[model samples]
Each structure stands twice: as C-alpha cells, then as structure tokens.
Target: MNYALFIARKIYNGGDNTQKVSKPAINIATIGVAIGLAVMIISVCVVLGFKHSIRDKIVGFGSHITVANFLTLQSSEQYPIVINDSLTKELKTIPGVKHIQRYAYTQGILKTNSDFLGVVLKGVGPDFDSTFIHNNMVEGVIPRFSDTENQQNIVISKTIADKLKLKVGQRLFAYFINKQNVRTRKFTIAGIYSTNMKQFDAQVCFTDLYTAKKLNGWEADQYSGAEILVNDFLQLDPISYDVLSKVKNKVDHYGETYSSENIIEQNPQIFSWLDLMDMNVWIILALMIAVAGVTMISGLLIIILERTQMIGILKALGSRNKQIRHIFLWFATFIIGRGLIIGNIIGFGIIFLQKWTGLIKLDPQTYYVSTVPVEINISLIVALNLATLLICVLVLIAPSYLISHIHPAKSMHYE
Candidate 1:
C-alpha cells in the first residue's frame, strides 16, 4: 500500500482534520481554474465554429475543387470540357472524393419592372448536390432538372430577389452578353435562397445545365467544368494532387485533359481571413493556461504553508524529502481534478445551451452567420484536459519544494 497516496486521500477527503488547509483559499483557486477553463472552452468553440461555417458557405457557393480546361480560369467565362464515363470513374476512385457534378456559368442580367441585377447564371446538372441550397433556402423549391425535357426554372438569392422585386413562379427575362451580340431567354423563379454571404448571394443565380449549354452554344456531351466534392476539407491538397495525376494519366485515351483547383487556392483572400483565427485561438489558449497555472501555484503555496508543522513532523520521523513532496503533489492533483470536473460541466453546459437555443446572435454582415455557432470536438476536449492537468501539476512542483526547507526544530517549536 502506498502511504503517500493514502495520506493524500485522507487529507483531501478531510477525514484527517489536522492535515487540512484553509478551505476558502483552496475554493478561490478552484474557482479561478474553473473560470479560466470555461473561457478557453467557449473561445475554442466559437473559433472553430466560425472557421467551418465560413468554409461551408464558400464551398457551397463554389465547390471543394474544380476540374476544368485550363482556359476556364474565371467564373464568368467557360470552355467546354467533356466529363466522360471514364473520367468520372477515375475521379471517383481517388480517395476522399465525395460527389462530382457538372456546372457551367455565364454572365447575364436579370430584368424586372422595378430593377435589374447583374448575375452569373450558374447551370447545374441532375447530379448536383443541393444539400447546401436546400438548407439555406429562405423560400420556394430548388430548380428541378429533367434530362429529356428542358426546365427553365431558376433559383435566385433573397438579396437579388428583393432588389429585383421578383417572386416565385414569376417569369423574368434574362439577357446574356455574347461576343457576337446579346441573347435573351425567359426563366421562371423556382426558389429564393440565402447563404448570408453577401458577395456570393448578390452575384449568383442557379439554373439547369441544359439551359447553360444552349446559352453557350455547346453540344449535349459538353460541360464548362465539373465540381468535385471531398469527404474531408483538411485533406484537400493531397486529394487535389491525386485527382490531377489520375486525370493526367487517363488523358491519353479519354481525351479528358483538365486542371484541378482547390477551394482554398481559388479564394485565397477569404481563406487567409480564416487562417487568422488560428492565431487568435492560440493566444486565447495560452492566456487561459497561464491564468490556471497562476491559480494552481497560489493554491499549492497555501497548502504548503498550512502544513509546515506536518512537514517538520514528517521530517523528524525520517520521511525522505521526495516522499513528502509526493504527498503534497497528490493533494494538489486532487484540487486540480475537482476544478477540471466542475469546469467541464459548466463549460459544456453553456455550449450545449447555445447550440440548441441559439441564445447568442451575431451580425450576419460581419460574421456571415446569424447565430453564434459552436463545434464540440471530443478529441480536442480530451487534449485540452490533459494539457491543463499536466501543466498545472508541473507548475505546483516548484512550490512543493518549499516543504524541504521547513526545519523540523523551527517549525515544531514555533507552531
């Protein structure tokens, strides 16, 4: 049986009243740790939540990656590329590839009685993933696509619809600017969606791929580009390279020569803004850890002072300095454990509450999300707990050494 652990538990449980320190000081330290941990947890939730929310909006507007002819560099222009069965099969085989869909965009203007808006008419094939659009649809239904029959349905953003005074089932005229002259088509408003991204929402309108092909004067087998979705956004770089290499290898037979562009590389400015959040998170984490460390240090010092008489008694009994240190360290560990447990409960409680109720509101213009978002990563929580425990224990060790300096005669006689 380990006597140090046994004695430490006894003191912690207050079964041995003589070994105890002032309750108030220990309570204050524990509260300090709880507050620090709570702040850290909330900060982590907001930062990661904001990062992912912005990323999903961008990906929804574009895609995780784009496979297109090298000439189709800008969103406004398109050079038709055929994504044949062989090319699709090869792309699917690449690890982490989620969904592939044909997409094409043309520059156009929407004209209503009251107003007009310059919009990019983005054409999507039947296989288009509409999950993001459905989630963010403020009103009406997504434009339905039929392979055999032409569907002239269009999905516009509330930002555009409101400005143009357009409504669902309303027939509007969209004029496309071509090199030769101008082309006009009648389109029905099928839906209104809002991604809360002002720039993307203002500039884009969705329609069927057939309409885009007809507008571009392309054949049935051709598409401006293929949008590729990946299972993991973090693995974009490797997956993009793998996809590019696979496409290159198949180009000999399939005649599917294409270049891949990662979502990050495509919109460098917005991603750069997201990257800045990491620095802010790191700074918050360091500050919280420092605060917790200082609180633990103060608590350990008090515990030592309160037990100076016991330290002397133990020393006189021939207890080694290391063994006595273990006793105090164990006591400090108990205090930290209590703080962490209570802190986790309080912190997670707030997180869950906000997640369910959305009690916190954010400015959509500034944050790109109406509600304050949160993400609870189990691995991150575990790492945080371990790091805090380890750092606090290490910090207490320096103060624990003061036990060795308490001379047996001086401590015993004075107290």
Candidate 2:
C-alpha cells in the first residue's frame, strides 16, 4: 500500500517519467471537472432558492394550510366560518402544527381621487406571525391588532400603493359590497409590502380581523377561515391530510361544517412549475457528470499510454497488477479532489456574491421575484461532491483494467 501510494504521489505531482507529456491531459480533465461541478452547484442552489422564495411568498399570503367552512372552497374565498375552541385545540395537538391564526376577508375597492382599484380585504387576528411578511416589507411596519378596539390601519402592497398614489399614514376609503348594501370605511395605510407575487399582491390588503368581520356583517366569533402553519413545508401533503381528517365534518358554532386546504393544492400550477425545475436540475446534473467523466476517461487513457514503459518496469520488478491499478486510481482521485476544491471555491464565491449584491435581476411580473436567489445547503453541497467523486472513481475502474493486460516484455521494447 505504501509503495502504491508513493507511486500515486509521484504521478500526481508530475514527478514521474511520464509527467511532461501527461500533464496537459490531466489539466484538461481537472478543468472539465471544475466546470461541471460549478454548473451543478449553481443549478441546484438557484432552483432550490427559487422554489423556496416562491413557496414562502405563497405561504405568507396564505399559510401552509387553511381550515374553513366547506363553502370557502379553493375557487372562492367569500364564505364565513366561526372558530371552535375545541377544534382549534385539536388542530394544535396535531403533529407538525406550527401556528394557527384567525383570518377574515371581504371584497372591497380602494378609492383615491383619480383612481380606484379592487382588492380583497384580508384581516388577521393577533395570532398572526408577522415575521414572514415583515421581511418583504419595503416601507412602514406591520400592524398589530388592538384588542381594545377595531384598528383602522391596513397594509397594502407596493403595487396597490403605486397605482392609487398612496403612502404610509395616508387615509383612503374602502367600499365593501354586499347583497343588500355597500358599506364604506376610512382606513389608514399602516404599511406597504412587496412580495412580487403579482396576482396576490394586486388583489389583497391586510387589516384587523375585527374590521373584516364588521365589513362582512359577521358576529364577534366568526372568521372566514383559519390559516394553519406547519414546521416542515415538505411534509405539507401528509399534514394537510391529517388536518383534513381531523377537521372534516366538524361543525362551527353557526352549524357550518369545516374542511382543510393546503397551499400546494390551492396553488397547483405554481407548485407544478416548481416540480418541473427538479427534472431540469437532474438533466443538468447528469449531463455535467457525463462530460466530467468522459474527460477523466480520456485523461486516464492518455496517462496510461504515456506510462506504458513504467507499467512494464513495475511488472518486471514483480509488482502486482492490482498495485499498478491502485497507483492510477489514486492519481485520478487526486485530480478529482483538486477539481472539487477549485470548483467549490469558485461556485460558492459566485453564489455568495449574488446573494449579497443581487447581481442577477429578474422580471418581477414574470418570475414573482426581482433578483436571482440562491441557497447554500451544506448537506446538499457535501452530497454533490461525494456523489461526483464516487461516480468518477467508479468510471475510472474499467480504464484502470488496461494495466493488468499490459505485457512487460512487449511494452518495455516498444520504442
């Protein structure tokens, strides 16, 4: 083992007899590996970052899951339901439940002197976790509902504020229409936020739950729905089913029955699009690995040809075939490791630069985000490197077998 390792070191360091001619092929293989790995790292980080960004925005607009009256189906958000203490407690007991907040909404239009835009007046109680949306706030602060009275403050999106020429602390009239009459209320702009989720941003504004209930003529205990948050979003499907099973056929105070809807189900198209990115990422990974592997194979064959006389000398000295193979395999391992180090440095440097500087820009109207996003998952990075190393080592196996077939007498005499 020590002799084999010594031979590997000499070959890897270009200190062996074949060093001068094999150097270029080895360098080419290393460069190929570096480029392939860098592409893979960027692809994974960007795809996961995009998925996380979009999913968080959707969940921020509507939590991971919703429990509401059966009438508050996926297509519409107009129905009303009252929260039952027992049902809420039961939901809290369910595994993975992170937060439960009361929400109410009614259709309304915000009017300015020259322009008016329609929006859904979404109201949240004190239980709402403002942290998710707070990060996306471009101006002002998220409002906390007061228990003493109905808060007249509302949070509107930048899109809404821009269209209506509204600003923080500005007052506007929002008119809610019902079957019998249209009720109008004056509201103060508490904050402005931008998720760049055009559809939700254009149609929704945040306010106190009491205000939404009052606008809809609902009683003190009533809400349109309860937004449910969970700890692990990837576990959302099973959690949604668990929530549905627990809340299904359950009745609210006004004899309304309840059901649960998860964010993925409610926004299928967005999630489906996100899923498609997985296939894209896999294809990229496969192609890159193939390129790197092919390059390494070519480099290995070149190294073998250049060192044919060395192999004959080693075999003539009674060195076994397996030992000769280990030398080349170890050499290949060093090349791959070097490439990984360089690739990681360059790839992570680019990722960090983009993260801090926002160098890459995207169209918010199309992608729901303004800048290219990236996430550095350490486990993923480690796995990628390990898998690449393993695959490259395995691919180098067949090529190394050429050592065993080399005859000492013929190779040594072949010019």
Candidate 3:
C-alpha cells in the first residue's frame, strides 16, 4: 500500500523501453559508488592495522608503563631501586595492573675475533614475560633466566646476530666499563629473535637479571626498575597517574626517587607520527564521499528528466511534490544498496587475502612491518554503508525539486 515505493520499484525495473536512456547513467553512478566505498574501507583498515602493529611492537619491547628511578630517566645508567616483595605486592593490588616484572640495564660491547658491537644488556628475572620475543624468535629458545642463578646465556636480535656474524650456542666475550674499570664476562647466545624494529633489534639484548645486576655492582634486593603491564591499553594514562601517586615520594633503600611513565610518554616521536595518520584518513574519506555524492546526483537528474511525461501524468492525477520526491529517493536507495553490496564484497575480499597471504610486502626499516596489515572492524563497516546511503539520497533531494517546476501540460509534451 506504499504508492511511492511501488512506483519507484516499477521505474527501477524499467518495464518500458523509455528507461533505456538512463540505464548507462545509472550503471556509471553505481560503479562510482562501489569504487569510492571500497577505497574508503581499505584506507581505514590499513591505517588501523598499521597503528596497532607498531604500537604492540613498541609495547612488547618495554611494557605499557615503566616505574624507574629519577636518575635512570636522565641517563642510560640504571640507578638501583628496591622492588622487593612488599613493593611488588602493593603495585599488583592496583586495579588495572596485570603483571609486574623486575628489570635492569647495563651497556657493554660484545667482541668476536674481528668485530665488536655495543649493545644494552636488558636484564630480566624469572618473571619476565617472553611472549613477544618467543613469537618473533627466528631461531633457538629463550633460556631460563633467573635472579638467583647466572646461566651466562643471552638472547640477541637477528640484526645483531647478522652484524657480529654470531649464532646461537656461540660463546662471546662482553666487556663492561664501570668507573674507568673494565670487567669481562663470557656469555653463550641462547636465542635469536627479530621484531624488524631497527631501534630495538640493533641495540638490545636480553640476559639474566643476576648478570645485569652484577655488571652494575648492585645487591640482590635492588634493580634498575619495574615494568608494569596493564589489562587494557585505554586505561594506561589513569593507571600511570595512580602508580606515580603511589610511588613518587617513596624512597628506595638506595635513596632513589621513583618516577612513572607510560609507553606514549617514553616514545613521543613515534606516537605523534602515528596520530598524524588519522588526519590523512579523514581527508581521504571526505574526498571519496564527495565523489560518490556528485555521481548519484547526476544519475538522479537523468532518471527524473527521462521520466518527464510520467511525472506530468502523475501530477495531473493529483500527486503531491513530496510524494513524487519520495519515489525518486526510494529509487536512489536501491542503486546505493546494490553498490554497497558490491563494494563490501570487493573490500572484504582484498582485506582477507592480504591478511592471510601477506601478498604485499613493505620495507621493515621504513614501515616497521614486513607485510601490509589490515583490520576488519564489522561495526565500522556497517556505519560506513549506512552513512553512504543516507548522504547520497540527501544530495539527490535538490535535483528532485526540478519535478515540481515542470508544468503538467508542458511535461506531457516534453518528448
């Protein structure tokens, strides 16, 4: 009993040959919409993927938040702090805290027969979360690193491994200079991992906390800092503030003041660059929507003009302008709906293919990822389709007004 929709469907089916002239225009409009939507979807997925991939890698290297001494923040040398059982228990009780692990850093040079490379030896205890490094392991396995035992085993990055011509199970000598005194230790490479992030891969290696602590001449109860993992990244800022308030004024046994910082604060340059990608995506979405709207307007105008005589007969039979406008809007909806279906198919197909096969590759040095990344968010895709259909119909409303201006008698003779 919906007369407007009924008439729109009849016109769309083109029972008569009169609609033939508008067929090509309609097809072009649908293609325009399809292409525009596909581009928008791909852009959104790729950008979101890039942001998440880079963010996770950075967090993997350190953690969501770090609580360290004030001196450690100012210099590479980690001033000792006491992260004893009492302090660990207090931090774990915080609402968002997931895990707390002890860590220390000491700088040294690994020497082989012909080459030497400087690296920061990251010391981790038995509680160290090796999930990230394990996933990225190219060869060998993570050793049992303990605070009480010195296994003399270390994990090196593929970048470092390649540069020093080193392999797992190879024994090498490392020299550490403390207050103008040179100390030497022999270590066996237990694992090799690669994150493809140059900053970490080139300069960081992992060892047992006891080894790192001994190099820094620290006691068993003292460490460089505590890395805190949170349940949700969205709560990082508030959790960091809560942690700072808890420990900021508290002095360690070594008389060191604690400072807390989140991953974003620790590496502002990389995060700022990621934030700028959002503006680029916004600009692309605007341009695509505009292109789709313009094409739909042109198609609507052509359909209206071609049906001039029908409009005249309907108006002569007492049809209102508003009713006539609804008919064309319904018709436009059909075209948009068809285009959206095709667009979704094409867009999702490309995304799945890329995600599974990683057919497209990028330079890790520049992009921080070896393959093009894509994220498929169902809610976002649905919103995009609904918004596209609504905007295209709204843009056609102005052109639909041309129907009211045409005199019935004149339009009947328009042919």
lDDT to native, each model:
0.85, 0.89, 0.91
For candidate 3, write residues 1-415 as lDDT tens digits.
7999998888788755554547788898899899889999999999999999999999999999898887887776578888888988999989999999999899999999999999999999899999999999999999989898789999999999999999999999999999969999999999999999999999999999999999998888888889999999889989999898889878976788888788999999999999999999999989999999999999889888888888888899999999999998899989988888888888898999999999999999999999999998889988998898888888888889988897889997797
- The TM-scores of all predictions, comma-separated, are 0.95, 0.96, 0.97
- In what order do the candidates fall by lDDT, top score first? 3, 2, 1
Model 1 weakest lDDT span, ten residues long:
247-256
Candidate 2 residue pairs in clash (backbone atoms < 3 Å): none
Q: CA shift at 298, candidate 3, in angstroms? A: 1.0
List, residue by residue over 294-408, the lDDT tens digit for candidate 2. Answer: 9999999998888888889999999999999988988899999999999898889899999999999999999998999999899999999999999999999999999988999
> Positional deviation of 280 in candidate 3, in angstroms?
0.8
Candidate 2: segments with Cα more than 4 A from true spot:
17-21
Best by lDDT: 3
Cα-lDDT of candidate 2? 0.89
lDDT per residue for candidate 1 within 181-259, as digits (tens), equals: 7999899999999989999899899998888888887777777778899998889999998977865533423364567
Query: How far in Å is the alpha carbon of 43 misplaced in model 3?
Result: 0.6
